[model samples]
Every structure is written in C-alpha cells, then in structure tokens.
Target: MSTTSTEPARRAGWRTETFARLDERLDRVLGATAKEFEKLRVRTVGDLMLHVPRRYFSGTELSDLSQLRVGEEVAVLARVLRTDVHQGHGGRSARGGMNSRLTSVISDDHGRLELTFFGKPQVMDYWRRQLTPGARGIFAGKVGEFRGTRQLTHPDFVILGDHGEIVGGAKRNAVLAEVTRQPLIGLYPATAKLRTWTIAQSVGLALDQLAGLPDPLPAAVRRQARVIGLEQAYRAVHQPQSKDEIDGGRERLRFDEAFALQLTMARRRADAKAHGAIPRVRRDGGLLAAFDARLPFTLTAGQVEVSEQLMSELARPQPMQRLLQGEVGSGKTIVALRAMLAVVDAGGQAALLAPTEVLATQHYQTVLKLLGDLAGGGLLAGAGPSTDVVLLTGSMPVAQKRAVKLKAAAGEAGIVIGTHALLGEGVQFADLGLVVVDEQHRFGVEQRAALSAKAAAQPHVLVMTATPIPRSVAMTVFGDLEVSTLKEVPAGRADVGTVVVDAKNHPGWVERAWQRVIEEVGAGRQAYVVCARISSQPKRKSTDAYAEDLDTDPGGEDIEPAAAAVDVYAELSGGPLKDLRVDLLHGQLSSEEKDAAMSRFASGETDVLVATTVVEVGVDVPNASMMVILDADRFGISQLHQLRGRIGRGGHPGVCLLLTKTAAGTTARDRLDAVASTRDGFVLADVDLEQRREGDVLGASQSGGRSSLRLLRVLDDADLIAEAREIAEACVAADPELIDPGLSDIVTHVERQAAGDWLERT
Candidate 1:
C-alpha cells in the first residue's frame, strides 16, 4: 500500500524466521477461531478490508511531563516499581444507581499515576496481581490535572520482563522518542477491555494484510487522472505523516465512489429506457382547458416554470426522470395536476404516490377542487379511473379500494392518488404514463424505482419536495436526473407573519397562541401547534432532533407527555377555542384513523388540527393560516423553514409563532434568528447544511447504524466531499470495473460494502 517503511529490519533478537512463523501461527489461529465469524460472514479476504477503523488511536508518545495536558492521549514505557489495588461497590443510591469502584496505583522511574476502573473489582484484582510490585511494564493513558498535579489514569499496561520488551531496548523515558519518530501506530477505538496488559492490535494487523493490494482500474484512465490506486489510498489515510497527503488520498477514494455512483445511475437510466418506446403524452387541451377556466387565480412564475418543464419532458417519447423541487406552499401539486391532465388527454392514466395516507387524501382533495367539474360529471373522454383521480389508501374499505382499482383499470378514472396501497396485490395500471411522488426524499432510490416499475412502459417520473436546497447542491446531488425548482408562491398567497419567543415566556406565548387560534377560529380557520420534545435530557444531540421524535406516554396524563403535541391539542380543544372544531394527528394514529381525521380537516369539517411535523409538507389545506411551534428552538434551520411553508397559502393573512425555552444554547438561538430573518428554503437549506447535513433530513429512514465518514462532518466536509466527488468521477471514468491489480483492494472493499459483509480479519 505504501513504500514508506516496508518492515522492521532485524537488529538483535529472536531470528526473523522464528518471529515470522509465530506471527503466521497467530494469524492462522485468529482466522480459525470461528467467533461467529460465519454469522458476520467473513467469507473472503476482501470483506476483512472494508471493516474500517471506527477511530484510530494514534497512540501518542508524550514523555516530557510539561507536554502532559489533561484529556490528552499519551504512551509511555513504565515499569511497575510498586503497586496498590482497591475495591468498592455501590452502597445505596437515593433510589436507583449502581455502586462500585476499582482502582490501582503503579509507578515508573519518573513518577507514579493512579489507575481507576469502574464497576469491576474482580477484574482489577486479576490485572493488579499479574503486574505484581517491582514488575516492569509499559503504560498508556490520558494525562490530566489531579489535585493540581499532573497524572495519568486508567492507561493500558504492558508487562515487560526486560529492556528487550520495549521493542528496541529502550528505557521508559527513551520509548517516547522512539515512538515519535515512527509515522505509523495502531489506533484502536476505545474499547471496554482497557485493563488488559496487552491487546492483539487486531484491526491494524488485518489492515496491513489488506494493503498494497493490486490495482483495479484501466491503465489509460489511471494515467489521465494521475491518482494512486486503492490500497495506497487506505495506507495514506491511516498512516500519513502529514495532513496534505491524507487529504489527497481520501479525496481520490471519495471521488472513486461518487464516479461509481454516477455510472450506476447512467447505466440504469439507459437500461430502463432501452425497451420498446412509449408514446408521448400530450393534452388535447380539453381537460387542461376546463381546469384552467375553473382556477381562482393565476400560477406563480416558479410554478409556471416547473409546469412548463414537466410539460416539455412529458411531451417527449423518452420517459422523463424530472424532479420537481418546490418549497412548502409553492404550488407543486398544481403543476402535477397540469401534467396529469396532459397524460390523460394523450389517452394515458396518471398516478401520484404519497408517503402517507393523510398526504394521499390531501392531494386527492386538492386535485378534486382544482379540477372540479373535470372529475365530477366528466365525459369519461376515454380516460381511466387512475386519471379520474380517486384515492387508494389503506384506510379505505377493501371493497372501496377494489372498486377504485376496478374503475382505474376499466378507464372510469383518469388519475389515481394513494400511498403504497397502490402497489398491493392484483392492482394494475390501465395506461399509466406519468407518476408523481410527493416528498420524494421520504423514499429511497430503490423504492422510487419500484414506483415507476408498475407502469406498462417506464412512466415519466416527477418527484416533488417541499424542502428547498441551494441550486448548486441540488445540481450536484440531483445532477443525474432533471431537476425543476418552484421558487415562488402563487399570487394571492399571503405572507405568514413570523415571531420568536422564549420559553421563559412560554406560558405567555401559549396564552397568546390560544388567543390567536381562538380569534382565527372565530373567523373559521384551523391552527397547528407543534412541539419539539416530551422531555429534556442533557445528552441529546440537539433539541431540534427532539422535536422530530417526541415520545408519548399512554399511562401518564395531567400535564401529558413532555412533548407538547398532545397536551397542547388537548388544552386548545378544551380552552377558549372550545367552540371551534379541533383535532390531533401524529405517528401514533393508525392509518385508517389518521386518514379519516385528516380528510375531515381538509373538507373544512374540522377547523383546527394540532399535530407534529407529520403534516409539515404533503398536506396542503389552503385555509390553514396559523402555525405555532412549541420548543421551536429545538428545531433545525431547515425544519423551521419547512414548517413556515405550511401556512400563507391562501389570500388571507396568516401568522407563525416560534416558541422556545430560554435555556437553548447559542447555536439554537442563532438558528432561530436565521428562521426569523427569512423564508427562502434554498438559502435556508444551505444554512441548514452548514448547520446540519443530509442526515438531518434522512435521519429516520437510515437503514444501518449511524453514518461513519472520518473526512465528512457536515460542518466541515463540504469541500472534501466536493473534491472527492470530482476525483471519484474522474478515476472511475478511467476504469469502469476496477481490474487493475494495484487497485483491486478498493474494488474488494466496495464489493463487500455493497454485499453488506464488512468485517475485520483478526
């Protein structure tokens, strides 16, 4: 992998052959151990390489006591001149808490340091007994100020029988310098077995075997990109002597991954459309004509622009893969309906898929109102039920769903709207030509594929998102597919006045919220009260994260769960707004129940709806002009922007109140200030990316454990990511299927990642 330092030259020790044989035996033993290695399915050497380091321990060498700072990592060669051990256990806590303390003391030539261990006295005794007083050993630990004196605690210990144990016949003090001169060190992530006198350095040894692997790319491309092969990259990453080389190596690898991704997309697009061509859909100007005549107002420039883009794409014989990105209330559905009408006019059915039942019903109603007479007593005009625009959610009776499906199949309906129920057994598309997915981010790349697969020919797909992102990021991230941005709200849409209020004044703000909702309800309008958390904790990532997932308590009442969604709804329902209709909806509601409730809200049967962000994007109720978020400081910049997009869709004036507690940190406060300052989703998305990451938006849908990219922290990795994406593309363009022996290691690593079989060899 690297030509820097190949091996340790023999100095004066056991013959190299003997040591080599011992090393080989150990490797064989680890490999044959069968520690559920089968379950982990480490079936090949390649899988072993992808088992990346969670964090490396660099194992710092710090002998100069003055360089010993508290909370810093350091390594030292110390012998146990004297030793002491202590044991303790939990006596009794106020109510609930464990009790135990295990500690020890060991000294070297220069000084002595305490070793504290928690929860296990038995284990401490075994370790202390092994390193009896006067026994020499190496120690490693985090140095800290204790009683105004420098100290090392709970460090790794190595029992050295003689000076030879130091690796180069060095004393305790000389060992620091010895390690400092070397550029490589095994950095193991913090583990539970720190009491061990020695560890196998399992990952490092495994990685070494995986390094300096064969290349996998084509020679011509490799020469053009001027980049090192894969194994070299990994070595540079873990063993770089300087930051520049490390960055360069990581960039090459990141670029390679992105390039592979781009190639995959390109190949998929080509394969999907290579089949017999589908006919282009064009509106006879009949259904579209009728709908336009019934519209109450003109579309905004942003809406018009996206509508035209969809129209142009749909007009093509090749299936369109365009995405419609519109901020909340930016009129995305309107454009969808226009495109659907065109497809129906061209004798094809249209379908819109939503992530949830409530959203499906909401889209159904909006389309019903927007396309009033067209769906009501329309001359079927040869369009099917899918084009006629019916709802197909799980909440509906089986008979009703089947009837809807039958109508859609029999060409009774021209357009269909539903959740995944549309994908159920026996469901069929008549002449489905266009498919629209609301909140496209809620689904994955595969699910998106499944949605389009249901059509006869791969239908033209239009994915819509209310979460706006900066054009640059959208272009880079969505560059593979066509992206159309809806950046303007249609005329007559009123601006929702926004306000920021602290929770120290929460009661007052709550009272004011009550007054406003009551006043709005007096004129017959609904209100939404959103909350961040049910409770507060010191260790949570952030308060905004709390809002996304508010736990509910069925047994606890009175004040309700710490998350305000339920309680606030209860309070408002029974408070001054008692005369007005009010309701609650969140994840807790069953599909059918949520559907029925949200339907009522959409039809104006219910005046107010108090809920979490569940209704943030997909549900569009034109009359909902008031939104109140409790613990607003707990939300990220992007979320607040989306929440604000919910209101101000109608001609009437609306308002948004961001209520939070005074305890919010500067970051939270500053985020809120940004929210109070603007309503641009794209600008906010950039700010949000700076504040959060794609992870923030996709947190709930993660398939594996939390993401791990050493070079990519949302706050700092933008540049690295950009560079990596570029390089990955360049390198992959050189070699599509990595076959260069020198770079085979990279392909091996990625293959294992794709197979989901990443693990360590030793």
Candidate 2:
C-alpha cells in the first residue's frame, strides 16, 4: 500500500474499524467524553462535522514576539536565529549543574522571541542541532517573561523541512503530498472541560472515518456560486491543507448559513401572501383623518412616507408583516396610532401590545389625550363618531378587567392596549384586523403568534421599535418582514447633550451628576436617576432580561455590585436631594407601586424618579430635563440611547450624565464613550453590532461554543447575504415547498439555530 494509505491504516486501524456513521448518536461514538460534547450541544456525528473551527493560526497569521503577553499559550512559526546551551546559578541540578537552561533566539520579520530549554547534555545537544541558525519550525508553548524579556520554556515543537514536512520523522517521497500540508493550527471554540486540541483530535478521527457526504447545495447552484462541495468544505475547515482551502471552506459554509436563512424568510413571505387577510382599508374623514387634522405639529416627511406605506399595505388582501424602526423620540407612536385609527375606521379592533405595564398605561393616556372627546364613543355626550380605547393589564381590579374584556368581546372597544395580559385567555377582539407590537424584541415569537391567533384571520402585524436597527440586521433578524425606517426627528425636539463621567479617574464627577439632577429639579423641571440593579445582592432573576445590567459576575470572584435603584434612591432622598420629592421604580416593585411611582413622576409630584431599566422605554416625561445613569457601563449602546430618549422631550433641552467607574482604556469604558459621543440610534446600532458577536445580535445561543453564525460575519458579509437572498428567492420560486429533502433539511437546521420568532407558522 502507498505510504499515505498505510499511515492512516496503521494509526486509525481503519483495516478493522468500521466507517463512522454520520447519523450515529454522539454518546455512542464518544463514550464518556460525550458528556463534554453535550455542553457544546453536539449530539450527533453530523453536528460535530458542522462544528467548524472558529479560526486557524497559520505561519502567516501568527503574531510576532512583540505582541505576546505573559502567561499566554501561543503557537509561533519563525526562523531560528541562533541557539546556545548554558548552565546557570550555583544550585545543584539533576545533572550536577544549577538548572541549566538552553536559550534559542527566534525571529520573524517583526520581532524576536526566546525559547528556553532545561535538560541534560544529550537532550540539549539534540535541541541545538534541531534549532540551528536559519532553521524554521513551529513552536507551541506558554509565554513567560524573565528580566522583562518574553521567553518560552521547553516548548513543544516540530522541526520542519523546507517543504513543510517533519524533518527525518517520516518517509519523504511517498507521503510528501500528504505531509506537505501547511503548518496550520485550527482553534476550536473550546471550554474548560474540553480543550481545542481534544476537539481537533475528535474531528480528525471523524474525518478519517466518514466519506462521500451528500452535498446539500444543488450542483448547478454550487457551480454558480463557485463554492466547494459539502464533503470538501468540511474536510478543508476541519483539516485544511492550505490557506486557500480554509477560505474556500469558509465561503461555502457562510453561503450555506445565509442561503438557509434567506430561504426560510422567502417561504414565510410566500405563506403570508397565501394566507388571506381582510383588507382594513381606510375611510375618508374617519378617526385617522380626524386625528391627523388636529395634530399640534406637522408630521415629519419620514413619518408621512412610512404612514402612507403602512396604509397601502393594510389595504392589500395579504397580511402586512412590516417592521417600523424609528429613532428615539421620532414620533413613531403617533404614526402607529394613525394606523390603529385606520383599522378602527374599517370596523375592526386594533390591539397594541406593550412589553411593560408602564408603557401600556403611557400609550393609553397618550391616545386618550390625543383623541380628547373623540375617544368617548357611544358613552358620553358631545362625542364624535369615534371609537373607545381601553387599557387591559394584569394588575387591574378584577371587576374593571372583566368589564374591559367584555367591551373588547362585544366590539365596543375599538382600540385595546395592554401588556402580555392581552395574550391571555378570554380576552377577545370582535374583529381584530391589526396587531401592533411595540418594542418588538421584548417579547418572544410565541407571544406574537398567540396575539395574532386571536383574530378571525391572520392579522396585519406592525411591529415597532425605537431602537433603530441597521439595514443589515433588519434583513437578517427581521428578514420575514418588510422594513421601514423613520429617521426624521420632529422639529422642536430639545437638543440633548450627553457626557461620560469617569468616576474612577474623577470621583467628584459622580457627585456632580447628583448635583446636576438637583439643579434640574430646582429649575422646576424633573430628572431621572437610573441604576443597573434594584439591590446590591448578588442574586439575579433569570426571567428578567435586563438582569445583565448588574455588573456582578455570577461565576467569577465576588465583586462590588454596581449602583442599585433602591440604594441610590435612599441616598439621594436623604443626602443630595433631601428637599426634593424622590421616588423609586424597578421590576421588583409591585405593579401598583410601579404605577404610583410613575404617576407621581409624570404629574411632577416627584421631582426625581430613581429607577432601573424599567424606565428604558415608553415612560415619557417631557419635563424631565436631566438624566443621571449610574454604572452606565453596565447598559448597552441601544439601551443608553433609549434611556436618553426619555428626556429631551417637550422642547426642554436635555442633559444626560453617564457615570461609570470602568477605567478609561477598558472596553466597557469605550462602550460608554461611544454612547456619549452620538445620539443617533442608527450609528449606535452599528457600533453595538461591531462590539458584539452576530449570535448576540440575533439572540441565538452559542451552540458550538461560538456564534450560531459559525463562519458568517453579518456586518462584513453583506454582499454574500444579498447574493444568497437572491438565490434563495429564486429557489423558493421554483420549488415553493422545497421538494428536495436535502434543501428542506438545511432550512430546518437553520430555523433550529435562530431565535424562534424569526419564523411564524400559520
């Protein structure tokens, strides 16, 4: 047999070993080690194959010695400049010398590194010969520093020939083709329990056993895209022979991810079109027109354009699946209200779902204020030919809740605004033609599906978010829906300025933040004091999505918790703002207490509202001219922007102070600085995506220890995504049901990896 065939036969024992079954359960193949793989969610051989390396470290990609950090495990491929064997110190060594160390100086074009070895004369001589001047090899070791110089001690290494083969270690001519593979180290996303090398070994074993895998991409499509076949892609990614192979492998995998996702979206669009929706067309001089005519200010051009688009979609027979992404304080609520009024005009009820009770109440009051007597349909004298707007919430008195439910059931309530309570049983809409979800990310897909299920037919869905989504994200995250952006900040909005206060470098700035709040309150305006937590306790409720705001690490060393709402409220009430009215609000508070606190603040009875991120959205107090966010580094870019949005309303120039103890050069501090630098939500969204992984942006779990994207970079691969989208649409057009089982399987796998809300089932 040829040396290449014999090497695998001898090392793998493939002569007796059966071919690895791709469909085999991991537990069967991995034995006890299967438990470790389970942590990474690799349950089958196929899953293991798909767990491609996150990155490869090759000679060209290795960092120079100057870039090495102390106590870091690293791999370096460099030319050996010189070698010296010496004995050091007075202490007796195993060979009767003071721990003799061999130092070899190695260099790349950029810098040099020291490789130290400690051994007897024979071993030292061997190393000396192997690491002579001008010799090139791969050195793997943990970096250390002695006398301020970086060094690697007794590193694991392989001396390589000019052609990249292990010198004198194996036969040259017969296995030259196989052994000349580039010296590249594939780094898997590893965990403490399973190291990267272990995973690589397992992958190597699987590759050796498996062969001739079916290609999911059609032959013609593969040729058109110029991507490698599935089997070749897997082999290249897992054990690439060259950098070109790695690139080819990653391109195919990226295309696969994008194609599968786009196909799912295309199918969803087709299904939405197929499912009939009653056209809730507008009526002239109806509630929408009446509401629009009485507007205190002219609608911005962006709002008018989006509103027109929404109305036209609502007039269609197909259900409208549209996403309205707007900047903070861009008057999105007004645009949504107009659409709701249009639905009411068509004799159908519109249900608006808010993520929080506070937001629901805010919307309820806003609608009532905007409608004035027009909201009192059939219930009051001198009322217009309008419709009733009702607020439904979990904390409402049982009798009041029952009455509201009956009105909704009897078609008397034309507009229903509520939290998740609207999705509960017995809350019926007589003719639910529209469903509007505010802060769409706050709820899951099941919640949205539940609300839509209430309508007799598929309800025209309009989901809105004040946190502007980048166009790429909108295409990937909300691919199933049509996207509309409202960037025009209405005229007369008070210009808001943001400043980052470095509490660590300048502790006085924190005190100044509190004083600023006092100053705003003294000027007859309100202010908000926001914190990252409700308490200093280390505990966090899993149900609270914002629990990440707490700076405490659950698994690492105990830390001094970030500022808490309750603690800040107490301190301010007694110290800085003793003369002013102050109240506290957080998710832990009872619903009544939260409402009362918000009400007090809204009515100017409370000069300062100390709260957690509960005030991040929809609690509008236009008179609130200042915001002091403590431990602001804990909040995200989008969240900081949203909290800042609460201010600068009602033509009161706003000031936002971001207080953070994070050091100036840290990533956390950089995030805070970015937020302070721009008020544009879209710019911040891009910054946020740049800082976070694609999996985080999509809200998917890192199943294989890396992003669900694996190899696809959402921001950098926009052209690839667009091409995949085009190809996907064409594929769906030709085979609407995805008759090819392989293509169907790919789509199903993609759906499993995504957030469940990305797809909606009829």
Candidate 3:
C-alpha cells in the first residue's frame, strides 16, 4: 500500500474513494439497518475501518467436565449420553412456564456433565436432535452446580457431525478448522440491532480495499514517532493476531489523532500571528499599579507570576490567546483584573464575559470594590481619568441595558461585564482591545469567536476557569491557547475538611449531617444545603434531580415533596431548621429573587441557603463555613470542589459533608471517596479525567456532538501528544499554508473540521 498523498490523481486509492462508489448500501453488507450505520458515522471505507473494537472476548480453552468448577466460564467437548424433560414443581408448563428444564447428560473420557436449557424450547429441540445418544459437540458456558452435580446452563454449542464418524467430509472439516483458528472474538461498539459478528464481517471486507491508501502522516514523522503505516494500523486494530499487535496499532492511531489536532492548532496559531493586533502594552502602569496598591491583601506568588506572563503577552503585537486555570479561591480574578487594567490603561476598552447572570453580577461587584477610588463614578473626585464600570445582563431593565450598550459603543465605559448578553446583536465596543471569559468551558467555541470578532483588530483574549484541568487534558482540549496556571492560594485562606457520609450504609447519617449544619448555624457561621434539583414538579425537575425522592414529604402540609432546592428549603425551614432563617435559591427563580436570596445570605440575614449547582462557581461567602451536599454522587468531582470552595473564604475552618445514597463499593462511591480524601484540585482533576472520558472535558458529551478525538486517550497518550505537538509546530513553521504535497490532505482535513465547528476550525 502507498502511504503517500503525493501519488498521482489517476491512482485508485481508498483514501480518496467514497464508500458510495464501493457500495452505496454498506448497511446490507453489515446486516444492519440504515439507522445503525448512521449511529456509527460510517460514510466511507475509511470510516468503516476506523470503527475499532471496544473490547475483545477470548474463547475459553476446552476443559474436562470433571475438572470444571462452579462459576467458571469453560468450553467442553463431550458425547451425549441421554436427554430428558421434567414438569415444573408449581404445576406449570414444563416447556413454557416456571418449571422448564431440558436436561441432558454429556460425557467425556474422564466424567459426565449435565446441560440444562430453561424457557428456550426451540433451542432444546434443536439440541436434542443434534446431541442424540452418543453424539458429540462443543459447548461453552459458565459452570453451575445443581443437586451436587456440575452442569452448564444455556451453553453455546456447535455439533461436529455424529459421535462415531465425521460426516460431510471436507466441508465439515473446513468449518472446524476455521473455528479452531480464531481464538479471539472482538466485541465492537454496536447498536442494539447490529451484532458484533456483523461488524467484524463488514470490517473484514473493508480491509481488503486498503491497498494503495495514501498515508496522511509524512514518512519522516512516522519514522521518528516509531509508528506503523496506516494500512497496518487499521488491520491490526480490527483483526489483530496477538496482544502486541493490538497495542502497537492503538499507539499508532493515537499518535495520528494527536498529530492531526496539533497540526491544526499550530497552523491556527501561525495564522493568528500573521494578523496585526492592537498591542495594549502599558509602561506607566497607572491603572494597574494604583489598583494593586489599594488591594487589602497581597498577591500570591502564583498570581504574580501569571500576571507578569499576561503583561508580557500583551506587550506583543500578536493577539494573546491564553487560558488562565486555577483552583477555587486561588485569586484568578486578581490576575485577570491586572491584565484588563493594562489594556484599559492603554486607552482601550476591556470586556469580561461570564457564563451566568449571578456570576456576572458578582464579578461586577468584585471589580468595582477592588478598583476602589480608581473606579471613579463617585469615589475618585478628581483623581485622573474616570473609570466607569458597566453591567449588562439579559434580566436587566431594558432602559438600564440600553444605557450600558450606549456606553460600550461610545467607549465611555472603561470596563464592561455581562453574561451571554454581551454577545447580543446590538452590543459593540469602540476600541475593544481585551476580552476576558470567566468559566470559559461553560461557553461554546462559537460564543468566544463571536466576541472576538467584535474587535476591529484581533483582540487580546484571556480565558479563565476555576476548574483545574489535568496536564494531559490541557494539551488536547486547550491545545490552541497558551496556558498559565495559578497554583497558590492567597494568605490566611482557611483549609476545608471534606467527609463522605454514606447514607445507604448508615440510615441515621442523613439526620446527623443535617444536625451538623444546624450546629454551624448556631455558631454564627452560615450553612449551605445543596440539592440536585430545583423543584418537585415533574415538568420543572432538573435533569440531575433524583427521581425516587421527588415524592417524599418529610415535612408537613405546607412543604412540597422532592429533593429539589424548593422542597429541601421548605423541609429544612419548617422542620429541623425551623428557628433558623433559611432561603431558597435556584436557576428557575427570577433574577430579582435570586439576587435577593444571594444578598440575604451574603449579609448574614439568612442563616442557611438551599440551592442547586448554580453556586458551584464564582459565589464567594466568607461566613458560610459548612456545606451539606444531598445526592453528592450526582455531581462531578470538579463541581463538588467548586461548591466546597464557596465556604472557608473568611479564614474560618470549613467542613464539607457529602451525603450519598449509593452503596459503598460502587463507582459512584469511589468517586465520592476520592473527593473526600483530599482537597487538592489538581489531584481531583486527574481522577475526574480518568473517571470520565475525554468528551466530558471538551464539552462534547453535553452538546450531543462527537468528541474531536477519535483514538487518542488524554490519560494514556500524553507523551505522544507532546511529540506530535513538537512536529506540528515545526511543520507549520516551515509551511504555514501547508501547501506542501505531503501535507495537502492535512490542510484539507483541518479546513473541513474548522468549517464544521468553531472549535476545530480555529
């Protein structure tokens, strides 16, 4: 097979050929429906070959009947001694009802084994005809013991002619030979109607068409990476002869995926560098220095380091596409503010886009407070130029929103902060130089691109996320953007203690957890009761709500029954926490109601606040020392960590109680235990990445779209990703347009990907 795109156009190659040309209805060949084929996304011969097996099942070695143990999956070849059927004990039909056992005794040279077929009369009849007295066959199933005798239940078997002699001569011999030759059975990721056998057969047909397939990766790159050719990798992945072949093939394909992504990103970076950006570089540092001087607390070393990096990037003419990642309560906001100040100091407008209205409002308040007199609407008097901070949100009054828009368009507002409303059609900036995105993952690629497009010159973009991303994940999901991490917590920040409360193992633990919350409230510290849902109504129930707990009313008449925030808030307020001031908060609540509830909690008027995961990010409260998470297992590790961060901001020791109804040994319990064991966000991030797949980290799973990665694993292929990145950087540096003959396919693929989604195309 030719592994080169440089081949003549006249050459017949699988890489350039469409599946329709080979066979329009590949569904017929695979014995699957069109819907099933669509699910696999198989449109070409390449796609068919790319549908690798999810797992492989090894055929058990044939074992003697006497040596078989109960619960052991084994294969046995024996001759049938006798067959019999008995009626059910409860006076039911022996063949169709409760008592249905088609029993047969099969014997090898060493001992005899019993076979039982239950509720499968057709199979029983077929087996009876095939496995008559002294007839031989091969059987495979899990061993079971009934009445002290070893037996096989619902065994899969193939009869080899008769016991005395082999019949059908060469034909029968060939069938046996084929079965004996294949020891491993591949189990593919298939739809309900499409079995693994059909997929395997179809793949076999596709492999035959792999001759002269042009390889996308250059020969030199493959040699340096130690990866096999494309054709070999595909064959080994689908029809491997040994474990080593499978490993080798997977590694090669993984490298290919990583390389493709890195090449696209490298080209994008190069393209951005070629474009001119309005450098918002500042030397006097008037606004930034003034803002920093007024801060009540000192900056951590990590924050200082990251802020310097951002300043340096802003000094360059190329637009800065950077991601600032930090753990909860790590002072990322301070670093972002400094960068924004630098831009504004250079006579440019800066915009901060938030994912939620609550977060946007909180950021606006934080920036206003931090800027102090320099934020000169009323406080500064005559101190230099007046820096007006404006807020715009979907829920804001129309008149107020119009005023903010006017200020933004006229370049009068030094800083503008808002949610998706900033991406609205009418919103525009006069000299937009910097764009800061908070909780960056919550927004899609299109949203970010839309904001960037508002600037006449490509704006300096800074994306910030409190959710710590593992190194491997950062390399793949955020490969296109430069990364800066804040690993240090600010001085005097209190440590949070996390505990897992096994509600299933100990029934009374739930009550004890609530009692802890009450005790925290009594101590003059606020408490938070986080639920998975927002309301008890079926139609209004959030996707994360626990279905079983939706109708249970622990508190009397006035309160509704549900595990949602409204029901939980009512139950706690009217029940155990009756004397304490409790308030309800959730996404379903009106903007004014949400603002009021948060304000009351912040002001200490509400002793306890019951809410959903809406409080997971950007909600800061110093007095809230305790958090009780109901159905904690439903939340991801990163979310739980962010929620825990809401407390312990006031230098008081904080406690996090995770209440889970799941059993101890399940995957859910394991995840909860991981969260409770440590407070390190980086460690928890790695664990989170392992627990879920790459799709979750990239936001593809939630969007109902396929992940950009097809073969690479963020956890296992870190080294390969690094290597591919180096090669891609070099490749793009040498040929920015990728017009080289060897790289034409890559250019075409990248362009196609970019046109499909804002993420891949960029």
Which candidate ranks first by lDDT, i.e. highest?
2
- On TM-score, the leading prediction is 2
Return the TM-score for each candidate structure: 0.72, 0.82, 0.81
Span of ten consecutive residues with least summed lDDT in model 3: 1-10
Query: Which of the two candidates, 2 or 3, achieves a greater TM-score against the reference?
Result: 2
> Which stretches of model 3 miss by more than 4 angstroms?
1-32, 37-47, 57-86, 89-122, 125-184, 208-211, 283-285, 377-383, 537-562, 700-707, 741-762
lDDT of each: 0.59, 0.76, 0.73
> What local lDDT does model 2 show for residue 440?
83
lDDT of 3 by residue, 293-366 (tens): 77888888898888888998998888898999998899999899899888888878889999888898889888
Once model 2 is optimally superposed onto the true structure by TM-score, how far is the C-alpha of residue 103 displaced, in angstroms? 12
Write the residue-wise lDDT of candidate 1 on 1-762 in tens digits.
110011111112322221232224333534543232333333333333333333222323222334333444555444444455544453533444443554455554456665554445555566656556666545666665567766565555555543323332112334333433335333322222321111223433554665444455455545555677766766665556665666666665555554444443443344445443366555555787677777888888877777777778787777788778876777778888888888887777788988777678778877887776578633245443223668898777879988999877776677889887876766687777788888865655445555566676768878888877554444334544678887776667788788887757457767777788889877877777776543233343322233322221111212222356667677778876787888888756887778777888878988788787777666677788888887676566766887777777777788888876644455566677778888877777777666545545432321222222223343444454454445555544555443343233343333324223112200
Model 1: ten consecutive residues of lowest lDDT: 1-10
Q: How many residue pairs clash in each candidate?
A: 41, 0, 1
Off by over 4 Å in 2: 1-25, 38-47, 57-61, 64-183, 208-210, 377-384, 394-401, 444-446, 538-559, 700-707, 755-762
lDDT winner between candidates 1 and 2: 2
